[model samples]
Target: MLSREIINLQVGQAGNQVGESFWQDVLAEHGLDQAGIYHGTDPVQLQRVGVYFAEVNHAGSQSKYVPRSLQIDLEAGVCDRVRSGPMGGLFSPETYLHGESGAGNNWAKGFYTEGAELIDPILEVVRKQAEACDVLQGFQVIHSIGGGTGSGLGCLLLTKMREEFPDRMLATFSILPSPKVSETVVEPYNAMLSVHQLVETSDLTICIDNEALYDISIRALKVNSPNFKDLNGLISKVMCGVSTSLRFPGQLNGDLRKLGMNLIPFPRLHFLMPSYAPISDPKTQSYQGTSVPELVQALFDRRNLLVACDPRNGRYLTAATIFRGNVASREAEVAVRELQTRNSNQFVEWIPDNVSVTLVSVPPVGQKQAAVALSNSTSIQELFLRTHETFAAMYKRRAFLHWYTGEGMDVMEFSEAESNSQDLIAEYQQYQEARAGDEDEYDEEEAPSEGFSQ
Candidate 1:
């Protein structure tokens, strides 16, 4: 069996403190085995994974400006391991504005401190680590594409890695910002463009949306914490969940090569809204808006099996609202119908038009509940299957869209070819039987026990 490895790189201000805390909490909570830290300059040996940390140089910095740093930590060590890594490598925008524009860097500091300088160093560190790893001959590398440092420098690093180690499986977990945040529109798009540039070079790219998580968090817990302390914790939990689902012995599927698959997993929130009915009691009938209890109940009702299974993946049902407005219901119904049509094959879109509803999807890296839930087997497995089906359906749907729009060759041709490639009918039948047997056993175990009459 091929062993899996994780190489973590720290970039920008977020990576310095908040990001680190989140990752540590996640690892500890999940009881993941820790590997040695991949100090950027060290040679990679040993049959283990490494977590590396580096600081990116934002434009504003003294002479000793470092763009980003990479570290590799095994699954066993305490959270304190992150502190031993380098600090102060990030390049803020202030440094560049003073150097090139010849203005008081502080004035343009916050606006221009894009951390562009760290791009090269980040790439260098990644390349060096890849070269040092003897065991990395067939290993895959997964990283993120979001945040100031990770999204910017990380993308460049991915490009460099692709050129240096063409054979390695390079996958990225790209984070999409929440719509409520100003950066949501441009940052994710930039990250996507970076991914697109290296798409053909890498094995696969997985996209995660921060907006979804934020919405869910606010709606479900009635709290909106954006600090790295909170956000990173959520993301770490999510990463741990995905890693566990693929690596845990009980969760593995014989037919799937977990190590070979280049997956980008993210969190999504689904919400449900029920139509409100007037109270029969003459005193309470005056209420026209949704009740708090009703909204809470709706959120719980729409919780996906996947979130319970893999909290780390950030797949959960957050909140639900009941709206009595006709306009709101009609608009929601239309949107839900469109989404259902789009994802008809794999997911059942359950949103109704006449209900006031909003679903939020958040990255689980910083979520507390999700982090705690990662160790549970039942929860992880359910999430694993749900995510698999969701992605598969998405891929198929996108292909169909491409084919229909004349952007690519007819997918039907490929489907027909796959159908005739082997005895799919027989294989499918066998698969169904096996699935049925497994379900039967599960049902038998879950069935109410027979006992003396109560």
Candidate 2:
């Protein structure tokens, strides 16, 4: 079978740094060195390498593997650092795009002024990258919604991709802003605006919260002061785990489209929360092999979620659990079924077989087993509710209004975004409170939900 290629777009400072960490792990997993040269003799490692890399041969040099990715930022600092970094040569020089000034943490500059100016060139490069593929699958974007370039321009690119390639899948690893680790004061505004766009543009959105990363680092990894590298490493692991089936041949292989189909029940409610299990500090030497039942329990544990929402608070609409490593299919099936049967109330009763299990033979580099769960639960509304409250607090006073309006944005747009976000939150609430035969009752009226205060 031919490999289905995916193009990766890393936008803004946060996106580029996270992308670097993800590539480092992917290269190691595929047995490729920093210069994209395959040093390992494992043919299985390189069999499906083309999924995320383009095999290239230079004059009189060994075959070099280049990542099918684009590094973009409104400012040149992040891209410059990546180019001069250790894994610099792994990416093509033409794939980097930058501007003179940064986005100043304002969404208007990224989406309208600075980001708008660069969209054409970015799409052109994307077109060239797609032309190099034998079977193009889709595009994955890694970005943060707190900053100007990542939030504004990242969303702008998504809308364009939908227009240019309507049939292709669009997925994102979105770093949402948290009150605990906010870099700027306007993070809520940026996040709300980004979520509004994501609801309309992205096919699949993987939510990652800084607060959750911090909790994992402090509790699981035993880190005192976790930096961006530590947080990005955790995200990279989940990203790899999510793509394990696509990157390697497995009995239960799944792709981006398959994941979306299973996890997403409703079109507008595509936000997914990802959880990874058996996460421990690297300083600890001894790695224990976790059983299938224990692994399933850990995957559902709120402490292990990449986002800071509790699944118990909201019912699960659908879930996809991907296991990587050597494990018996019967064990996995029974474990998941047992879990579902034991906690049937946690899932919506209407959907039959709400939980999906996929197993891949190859494990991570230094682990006996790894499992990642993508859950489309109503509890994700907690995140949206948090951002909406903050945005409302600031928007009521017209704070930071001039910055966006100066960039040719209308004040009405903010209101519209707020309303759209409220509708999304309400829709999730409606389905969450929905029961098996009570679906017709929710179709009566579309009133604002007062229960969102929780």
> Who wins the lDDT comparison?
2
Q: For this target, which candidate reaches the highest TM-score against the unseen true structure?
A: 2
lDDT, candidate 1, 257-297, per-residue tens: 23222111211111111111221222333443443333333
lDDT of 1: 0.32
Superposition-based RMSD of candidate 1 using all C-alpha atoms, in angstroms? 17.6
Error of 2 at 299 (Å): 0.4
In Å, residue 49's CA in model 2 sits off its true spot by 0.6
Clashing pairs in 2: none
For candidate 2, the per-residue lDDT at 10 reads: 99
